[model samples]
Target chain A: MEKKIAHFTIDNKECTATTGVSIINAARENGIFIPTLCHYEGVKPAGSCRVCTVKVNKRHLTACTTPVAEGMEIEVDTAELNDLRSSVIELLFTEGNHYCPACEKSGNCELQALAYRFGIMAPRFPYQFNERDVDASHPKIYHDHNRCILCKRCIRIIKDEKDLPAGSQGRSIFAFNQRAKKVKIKLDDRLGKELSDELAQKAMDICPVGSILVKETGFKTPIGQRKFDKEAISLDNSINLKAMKEAHHE
Target chain B: MSKPVIATTSLAGCFGCHMSFLDIDERILDLIELVEFNKSPIDDIKSFTKDCDIGLIEGGCCNTENIHILKEFRKKCKILVSFGECAIMGGLPAMRNDIPVKECLAEAYLSGPSTVNEEGILPNDEELPIILDKVYPCHEIVKMDYHLPGCPPRADLIWEVLHALILDVDIDLPYELIKYD
Candidate 1:
């Protein structure tokens, strides 16, 4: 028999079976949720958003990228983790143009929803509310680079999952003006509306923020009509990773 | 000087978002000491009146009633907030926009005779509405002042929106959103 792994209880739910998955994935598999500001199901793990930060044996680690272990004690929503999450959220508010009300991806925005999840009812930091360009170069998709959180999930998903050309991966403002060698190798699928439908699905689903929203379909549905509201599903976890990936791709 | 009168409402959604509000739980009581849910399905009251300092509207507008409700709130609420993804975009319902609206309806109400049977047709209740050929973000219909974007608006966002509204403080997003996807 294999070596037995330790167990953990989140609000009393036994989460020991997910010993091999990440903390966030484990939590998600077991119906536990950790707020994430910059994470997606279809993409590779990027621990950019500190919102999923959890106290694993009193040490802070991002649930999105951190794996689970046997007999490891973890606290997801403690005062320290909550404060750290809040600080991370406050920073995002200041960095980007997250004008929730006027923006298109308001109701179903991952960033906006996480704010509500972590109880960031108020933004303590100043809004770096600068005007960022909306790269609507592609007819089917519109990406507001200003709102990007630099999770690189898009780049990873395209390169790692879909096996697309490197250029199709997006450019991050943080890494936007990086070395020239990097700029030499980028994917640019400048196709027409023939691929609009497919592009729209991928872009919208990949964006954790309201950045790459689908055009023309804004506001047709109201906020109350979305999913994952009552229960928090930590995308960083692997327990439900299979289901989430299937649901995400579908 | 006046206190912010807050109200929340939902439309063509699973009500999971409205349920997300409950994630705050006891904190909501603390929130309510100042703000009020003028016309929330879960909160007290019916038929949203208007003129709220902050209005957190969840879900997207899928039917005539949804359109009416969105317009009414847009007019009445001083600060109209698109509370959830449905409010922001059409969320999953909008996914059907990829298909024909009629086909979507047929697939649900008619495709399967066993589920759609009885008197050849069970009268359609106005509330159990049909979906559109496409899904959209809320800004297409009305002007939104603040947005809490999420499939289910985050508990952090709920707390932060409330705090920003009440304390009148500014907020900057965390480094994570910028650094990651």
Candidate 2:
């Protein structure tokens, strides 16, 4: 069956997308970058973080979860939206003990990148200074609750594929056991011991912040050489978009 | 008109922010031309001799002395800037906020690995400033007009803010200039 395509307008630009596609992915397909923290490629959108909140027909809705509809009008880059997004970033900073200077993910952290994009000099809200624990029980990955934005990327991305047939078909074999109000990314003890280095790296990469880190190796990249040091995150994306536009022109 | 008077001080911090300010290097000559130092370690000035236009404060208030100096800065300076992570959000010193004051004292003086006092002596000199229960960001103690967040705020950031303030121009802080580390 042919998928029904929906026509929409985002930030006054006309956008056409499949009916079931989330607004964020649709915007991305059209080269319109909507800043997000929790939303990851290929993972189910949780809409836990409101960083990607946008006005849909004059009402606030998370772009990551909201499906693109026919003739839907969306506002992404309004001043009010930017201010609201900045406030969310600030609240996340204060709520967690984010000592960026000492953190392993100082340069590459998405949270810090968002702060830089928003020009957040300081959080308007008072710092909570909540004491959180670090879990280094796993041999490969260490989880620092202090830096976790509760994005649930780890919880959602890593999954069990034990029931599937062996070989190329049985790649995914991890599970997360978390409860409401108290969410934690858990790995089975036996599976954790036998977890491949690739999977461990995947977990670290999936995390937007510096919450999950690989043990035995850190600070490998120097200060100036690190990601988001020479250029901002969005700058790279915009550059790519520009290059693509130029290619199309040619 | 006279050059803008700038005052600076380190409170409960390690003076790393001051060091980063010094990282401005040759820009100091330009800064000198733009603004005059007052009651700053740059000139070894002991106290505020006159009303200042700008005050760059490092670190948070962890002791009575910090509170006193911060209050004085609020009174003397027209604009107070929290100059680093310590001043903006309590920084490394804020780690003790989780622990009780008594435990912190015990860890530092009596039961610490570095402690050599057999008498379990905790410094209680009358001349010494009393320690606050917990370290506090400068904004909590006094109204802060601006904040430059970093362990030691980036040198370019300090220079840019100073330059903007002195020239009476709007500051357009670039992404590279506004790092937390």
Model 2, range A1-250, lDDT digits (tens) per residue?
8999999999999989899889987898887878888877565688999999999999999998999999999999999999999999999998888988889989888888889888898898988877777889888888888888888777676655565666533433344456654555556676677777887887787678898899988998998787788677673443224434655686
Fold similarity of candidate 2's chain A to the true chain A, as a TM-score: 0.86
Count of clashes, each model: 102, 1
- For residues A158-228, what per-residue lDDT tens digits would candidate 1 score against the true structure? 32224456667643211233443222112245323344466556656666677666677776765445433
Error of 2 at B78 (Å): 0.4
- Which residue pairs of candidate 2 clash? A159-A174
Model 1: native contacts recovered, as a fraction: 0.00
lDDT string, candidate 2, B27-57, tens digits: 9998888888999988999998999999999
Error of 2 at B90 (Å): 1.2
lDDT string for model 1 (B13-114, tens) is 778777778888789878877766677676677876656777777877777678777888888887888777566656566545535666666666666655
lDDT (Cα atoms) of all candidates against the true structure: 0.63, 0.85
Q: What is the lDDT of residue B169 in candidate 2?
A: 93
Cα error of candidate 1 at position A226, Å: 4.2
